[model samples]
Target: MTSQTEIRVLEISPPESLDSPEAELFHGGVDVEFAIAKQERGYTDLCPSAEEVLVSLRSQKYYKKIRLAAVAGLAGAPRREDVLGWASIDLPRHDNLHLAEVHVAVRPECRGRGVGTALYSAAEELARDAGRTTILAWSDHRDAPSTRGDDDSGLEAEAILRPPTGIGGVPPDDAPTRFAVRNGFQLEQVGRHSVLPAPIDSEHNSALLSAAEQRANVPETYQLVTWKNRCPDEWLEQFAKLRQKMSTDAPMAGLEIEEEDWDGARIRDEEDRTLAFGRTSYVTAALHVQSGLLAAFTAIETVARSTEFAFQGDTLVIKGHRGNKLGQLVKAVNLARVLTENPGLKRIHTWNAAGNSYMLRVNLDQGYRPEDVEGEWQKRLQESG
Candidate 1:
């Protein structure tokens, strides 16, 4: 007979890192759990590299600056080797300081026994203790019931992101979805996940880019500037402005997200962290030729070991600069750069608001294919529990 799962914190003092044996165990456990989750999602790839975990949670170079805390729970016992699941709260130093993002995973065999709930409870306590009132979390699943736009075969139609009403108080169909919903969190935003095959066929990609270029009729008054790792010192101020615009201008739909206050210093801090982790970043931006102002930008990140995929970060074209196809131009420029630099990278993954038809069309035109849907959930800790 299976034993009852017991959940509690796997605590380690500060100045500690996830590279420790206990952390590694939990890290490896999470990888195994992710593998199971992916298989369930019909994905064939392995979980994203454990290196990302170590870099995020264990990098002392990022300690007080980022302020990350981890907690793990065990099943039926308080042993390091018995980790049933674990969660981490990432409090980014520069932005979203008032917010904490909880990332959790449970071992495949120990799921459905409240192990995930236990980890979340522990994480919530940590957030509360840190004086954080805003908590953001996400749930991912496959084969979920499609809402209105679904075909008879259950394939979901393009969903438009709408403002959330309130916590449904209704039970969700899956354990993962229910964990957050039952805990009083409201679904704030919906995103569609898509992937673009990498090691891009240069001939085909060139054709796509040329087609977009022709259609954009990008004004002769604009020019493309590309870089790696960080923007030029001269461009940091305008670049920061674009980032702040992303917070409010991007389609949040119903999400109650506050504006992200980005500046040159914060941008520098991010670049430093990226350098410490030995990752590669590509940025492509449109410079208004005569004005010398940055009109829009797009970026992609990949680690040296990222042979399979690169994470697409942000692509934005300011309001006044819209209609120039700057979005497609910048994204296409960066995609070509990433393909050239990281020849082994075979795919690029990005998530977009379900209602973002403009950006979605841009991605589709660049050969991106829809893969899944995910929710960005939000909880006001003080109001709930």
Candidate 2:
């Protein structure tokens, strides 16, 4: 026989206790139903499964931010005792330690009974404990009405409702545009998702390479070379400078974000972390001859998990220097190398902001296309309340 306990907050530890059939039933079962309900109401594909949820919970990036919750009731009704929701809060901006990003989720069975409210309240308390004063939430709004085959808009509508939490204001339209207006969250930015299709013919690849070769001539004094061997201390210094300069020059809409400070210690730490994950299979760097300038570089790490094949992680490139088509040149060469080295690799995936047309053109010319679109929306909790 299982004992019953009161509903309260508890600090669960690693090696999650929710492993038994009863616990898995509570977690996975509720999640499956929640997804179907959301889908039926036109919420589309918004739910995350237990495995994915576990991954996010365990991720190094999110380990410090996540808060778990469960209801405590009778044994047979363990489903009623199951943790039906979760919230994660990111650390504050380095400059302003008082602000943080808050992510929230609630099980369908627990909705309307104030599960979101409880989860959000607990999140804010956690934030305050972490020395944060404000929370930002992100949600999406689709233009078309849900073709979910059900007219449960009313129930589906409550998904975005964020009542006054007293500690902070909820920005209106933090939910989708429609629900935001209906419930009170306001829209702060107009965002869109776009894709660059994969290149299909030799003509497309040739054009991309040509553009890059032409751009390479702009800085005639600089020589293009792939990054090899240990990165020299001087090279790292130049790379850091270029990184900051490009970040400051990149186009931003309305937001007054500043370039993040780069330091050698931090760079070393990141390098150590990446190496711990796996060995780097591909790295490309371009340097100037006369001034020893590190103008452009790109790195691709290949992950081989299954016997069938492999895929490419998104390639990172500094801005400003990209227009000369150096991005295309660097990426094309890197992709060709990967294909030649690893046979039977079918596809590659990458993502970019919808407004970034230049890189989109490069990827499209290289035979890449949009596989998926992830939306980003922000709401100011201080103002919304």
Candidate 3:
């Protein structure tokens, strides 16, 4: 063990200015870790492209709630040239405002040297200053990902291991998990991550579209409404309803996740956030003509810098409107739109709970494959005396 040095941690650039040396180092470190996380999980497609990373690094919207603190080497001299590591503290504004999510990453060579501890200290300080009562973190394990996407993948993985189980889960001595547990954090929940290959096979896609279309009434009882960025005012209210339903409809495996409490204003904020981040969201909704409301919806978000990666956002079908294959319908349509709009983006990544069989089935049918498993951890910051 090495002595703790005086490493300096500073908040990153103001939204208006992002061209300083420190800013670059912080963003570059985050970008590097993005790829590293994917490599660690051995996933073909589970991270933002380097280009996307830089683009987001410079975007105000992406960093709005995100507080980036970069740690510098404590050379004990005048110049601190090397960037040891960084911490990211996300303060959710509208919902879960009291919660602060954190991510602390240090250079591989810098581990066990107290760099991560310093970074977490910075993050917790930020969270506590923001009046956050609880801080949450996530740890992604390598062997936890499914080798293949099939009925047995989820079941077998759970049978084989439950993360943080202390038996076969991320060990107490593991790097990421160890860092948190050592700092008084407890395991919260785990989620299965997956990815969908882009530029879907022409033959398979056509058959899939045809299959979903056949589920809806051929007489056109349900119609499709789509948009590039913002939801149409006519459908805004109904869309909000679907979004709220999604917050609770999905399975939350023992996690303290609160409903998004969506509304038209929040919808607008989401759209604005997408624009601020220099990204585009291709959205599709199934409109129930008789009910005059949206029955189902899905979205595909793309960053300008990362033409090869697209994030598959929320996809939901209201309970009453379920079973019409709307999940498949909306997802299929949006995937097609993403492929057509951004041909270079060859992969669409998404995450789902292992128990979410219905959504998993729809995603599997749409060409998604297993990628990795992520576990959420939480630490109720004890009030400092």
> What lDDT would candidate 3 get against the real structure?
0.70
Query: Across residues 205-243, which tens digit of lDDT does each residue of candidate 2 receive?
Result: 666666777767744744556553235576776656655
Lowest-sum lDDT 10-residue window in model 2: 162-171
TM-score of the candidate numbered 3?
0.82
Q: Compared with the true structure, what per-residue lDDT tens digits does model 1 show for residues 1-385?
A: 1233434555433324555644545454455556566657655343545555445555443223132212243433233445566666766454566677877777667676666676677777888887778888877645433322243232222322222632111124656666777787777766777788865667776776776677556567678888899889989989989989989888775555678878897788778768767678889988887788998899998866646778888899988888877888888888888887777777788988766889988988888877666777888877886
Which regions of candidate 2 fall more than 4 Å away from where they truly are? 1-64, 67-83, 92-98, 105-117, 133-203, 218-222, 227-234, 242-251, 276-281, 304-322, 371-373
lDDT of 2: 0.48
What is the lDDT, from 0 to 100, of the residue 359 in candidate 1? Answer: 95
TM-score of each: 0.82, 0.62, 0.82
lDDT winner: 3
Tens digits of per-residue lDDT, candidate 3, 43-77, equal: 42445443444445554432234545445544332
- Indicate the residue-level lDDT of 105 in model 3: 73
lDDT per model vs. reference:
0.68, 0.48, 0.70
The RMSD of every model to the true structure, in order and in angstroms, is 4.6, 8.4, 4.2
Single out the weakest 10-residue window by summed lDDT for candidate 1. 62-71
